[model samples]
Target: MMSNSKEIYESITTKTIVAEINLSCNDEQIDSISLTSEDLQNTIRIEAESSNSTNESYCSNIIEESEYKPDVPTEFVPVVNSVFKSLNLAVKMYNDYAEMSDYKVKKFFELHNHPLESIEERPYTKKARKMSYFEKEFVVHASKAKMGPTMAHKIRAVLKGGYEYVRVKVTDYKNLRRGVNIILCYKDAQIMINKMNDRRDHYPNYSFEFLRDGDMLAVMFWADEREKAFYAEFREVISFDVTFRTNKYKMVFVLFTTVDHHKKSVTVGAGLLSRETTESYEWLINAFLSAHKGKAPKVILTDQDPTIKQAVESVLPNSRHRLCMWHIMRKLQANVTDDLLKNKDFKKRFNKLVWNMHIKPDEFEKKWELIINEFNLEDKRWFNDMFELHDKWIHAYFSDTRMSALMKTTSRSESMNSFFNTYSQFGNLLLHFMMNYDTSIQKQRNTQKELDHLTKKAIYKFISPRPIEKTCCKSLYKYIVL
Candidate 1:
């Protein structure tokens, strides 16, 4: 009975204390104090208990699965195999952990430190070495000595020193030769200039000009006495066109050409211009005229380039300018449809409109409009532009000039380009290119001599055996048989 009475007294005292704490929390007088309430204290205690429970659970799991081993049957032989595997696995795990730790430490240090330069593996592997000055000099000497063999043969001859100092493959040798050519281009030009002056002294009629832009050869014009004599005879009509990428300097190769009496292309003068501009054309044309003693041709045919046209108009006002009909016709396929190009009737009609010298200008205009409208090509911009320039190229307008069938197109210049390509290639040193040009010219002159001999000896039979034809043939010079 006493113990029960004491328990009740203690329980009543505990309830009264909890009630007093609740009353203090709810009272407005204690709102300004910095003490935490019972709710907040309870939340803090719950969070602490959850955190400790999580740590205990994690520790238990880690210890329980710290090192797992596969089960083995007791009846199996070599029971020590399992033990050995576990020991090896433990060693591997230790090694992995050590490697990871080491990697992390190194990464941390790398992040804080300046980076080192990255070195390439096998830096010199499969790369071409730079050619020495002696090797390059030998290449030049060999080329001159052998009279310009292919790059492969040139390499073989150059590496005859047994591949010790010159350890270059064929391709590497070619690249090195190009570099050497570029290096010696200016010197080669100087040598060519000296040679030209020497020729001029020996043959007083030889004319040449040397033009330069800084260290590069800009424009070089040369006409030998034989070339000048040919120009004097065939100066009635001339054509010039620009060819490119035929020398080390990659200069423009401009050829002034004419047609011989036998309808053969003959080169009159040649130039290497660094640029293709109105100024360059102007200078080239002026040089050509000066070389021929200011005798401008009656008709000059060229590709329909606007810069060249403008230069011609400014420099050769007395000369009639005609765009190459062949050049203009080549663009038809690109500008017109395949169906139209395949139509034989359309091609025939187009050729008639372009080539028939009997067609009047008014008739040509009517025919051109009818053809365009019939072909539904009225909206084709290139065709329209070409139609606008018909007077410059059409045969009807060309009738008024004394072109004399000497040149209907710049095909003579194109032939000259094709002929030069047989001997010269792109990136030949400037001097070497000029020397090749001389050789080509000499060959052409030799052919001309052979043709002259043929004409003098061979009697051409007339296609129509008429009395007047025989008389005319008898009266004509052997060179004019064509």
Candidate 2:
């Protein structure tokens, strides 16, 4: 009878405490504290029974399954038998026992203090944004196709019906591309090397060389069988120049180009260098020479880069190194006075003297001295420097060099670089750059084949009925037929 009375008293106390806690907590906090009152009551009853037993250790099996029926919702009521009938009553009794036993019960409400974001704004959250496998693959293929992130995103939106249907944002596409590049940064060099190796294995004439600084690739050069054949035939005069901003690593793109029989710019070979130092240029030149069985061109045209000049001199000691006339002439305004450049008489005489190919070197020198004296430009630093290097730039000095007149400037290389830039981008990975380069080469080759076909089928209407004209027409391309 006494035990029943005590149990009744405990159940009332638990219900009062539970009500107080419920009143103090907010709805969110109450939700976060997932522990039900029934569970707390079960624990309290177990502890009480264990304390009364001699064993002292709590055993959960003391509560029989028959004592608590399933599907019976707990409520606030008097304790019947020994089973817990009320969650509120159980919680209050557990708390009182905890207080007496000096147990500090901590209610950890794991709820966020800040208000939650709405469902509409949740997708824009950083944690919620992600790119799936298909999306990443799309980005990779799109990048390879020379489409940027913004264009790729727009195309995806169109394919998906609308921008609203797209799961990821434009920024996500860009971020994925950037992440892919970062991941491939270490493997790209090796991948390129392997690709080149495979090509060389398949085509015996394809050649490539690479230099590394520690484990990082520093320089690379490559030439295919067709390019090698082109070099062998049209290797008399080749223009070499470097283009910048062509890859993610900012590597200098070195191009060796020459005019083919069709008067088209053909790529002889190409290279990439981490830096444009004299040593790097020398290595690249040596690699090119090695690829072509050490046969240097008769005349090589390039810009006014002293490092390239030094490399050419050291590597191709026998080959004539000529400066690009266009590169030098383009700097006239910056190096000379506006008044001097604008003078019609000066421009007329200067253009004639600089461009004349029939004049001898001695006559060219005399004429140059006369122009300087007439213009009163004796103290001009640019003129003095150019005069010192006159042999490299003056057509009269290297006039005898075979096909030198055909490529007097590096314009072919510059044009070829522009063509490549159309297929490539400034933010390209090494693999993508090479892929685009191959595509460009294939397009040029196809164009060359088309031109060859047209030339073969062309029938000329001769203005003069001369055997020499007919012979020339038969031997030369349509553009070169005179």
lDDT of each: 0.66, 0.77
lDDT tens readout by residue for model 2, 136-224: 88987777567889999999999999987687999989888788788887798898889988998898689999999998889999999
Question: Which sections of candidate 2 miss by over 4 Å?
Answer: 1-141, 153-179, 463-472, 475-482
Native-referenced Cα lDDT, model 2: 0.77
Model 1, 158-233: lDDT tens per residue? Answer: 5575444345544565676676666776578787778888887898698888677897667778888777877877
TM-score of 1: 0.60
* Each prediction's TM-score versus the true structure: 0.60, 0.67
Q: Best-fitting candidate, measured by lDDT?
A: 2
Residue 401 lDDT (model 2) = 74
